[model samples]
Target: GAGVSQSPRYKVAKRGQDVALRCDPISGHVSLFWYQQALGQGPEFLTYFQNEAQLDKSGLPSDRFFAERPEGSVSTLKIQRTQQEDSAVYLCASSVLRVNTEAFFGQGTRLTVV
Candidate 1:
């Protein structure tokens, strides 16, 4: 894909359910980031992956949230035991360089916990 791609643009999960969102970044991109955005707010950093290694995950809210980029090109963000407070748009971005560089963002997966 020429741009970042995210699957199931919208997801509805019941409270306590688990949801997995997928992100396919531009091929060969070296940096991938996951962010959570609440309504009308800017994206909040969740995790960052440089290739297959996870360098930063301090922004993850709880143990229930996880992200991985196994082969480096594609990544997944999983939320377990979803709560109503977890409802938000999960954004994925990729850049050729490290943090602070220009990045391309996916449309995001809007998860609604009801």
Candidate 2:
């Protein structure tokens, strides 16, 4: 019954450095989603994966953002050439699959680019 978790609850980066954040979803979860939440804004979907297959990635801001789930369980989101505009709470969620399900969120990896 492990819940989702993210590392480095906080991160501060330079204006153009790359950073990789990690996410560990609940065991046995088949669907995982990544979202970016700006200050006072609702979480916006960044990408989704079912098992090891990436099902959607339309919300990724730009080519500078990338994500992957190779083993169907653990995943990572990498941001390249970080910008002040990229500063936000990166959240990871997971649910059972194929229907309406509740998504559990982590404390989030808060990235700040200065």
Candidate 3:
């Protein structure tokens, strides 16, 4: 796809289930980010990856949440032992530069844990 693409646009998981969300960023984009958007709130930064290196992950809520961009093109966010509070719209964005550049966002995967 020309823009960022996220798979399984919607997901429903039982409490304690594990889920993996995928993100495919635009070709050659160097900066990739993961954000978690709870209802009625703006997306909050979860992590940032420049190329294959994860430069920042301080925003991640807990160790149960994991994100990686192994080859730097495709990324994944995994939530383990899903809890109700973990439900949100997981957004993926990519930009050409590490800073001062507009990011292109995907439609996001909406996760609902019950």
For model 2, the local distance difference test gives 0.94
- TM-score, model 2 to reference: 0.97
Cα-based TM-score, every candidate: 0.98, 0.97, 0.98
What are the per-residue Cα lDDT tens digits for candidate 1 across 1-114? 699999989999999999999999999899999999999999999999999999999999999999998898899999999999999999999999885689999999999999
- Cα error of candidate 3 at position 86, Å: 0.6
Report the poorest 10 consecutive residues by lDDT, candidate 2.
98-107
Return the lDDT, model 3, position 93. Answer: 97
Least lDDT summed over 10 consecutive residues: which range in candidate 1? 93-102
Query: How many angstroms is residue 61 displaced in model 2 relative to the true structure, after the best TM-score fit?
Result: 0.7
Clashing pairs in 2: none
Better of 1 and 2 by TM-score: 1
Cα RMSD of all models vs. native, in order, equals 0.6, 1.0, 0.6
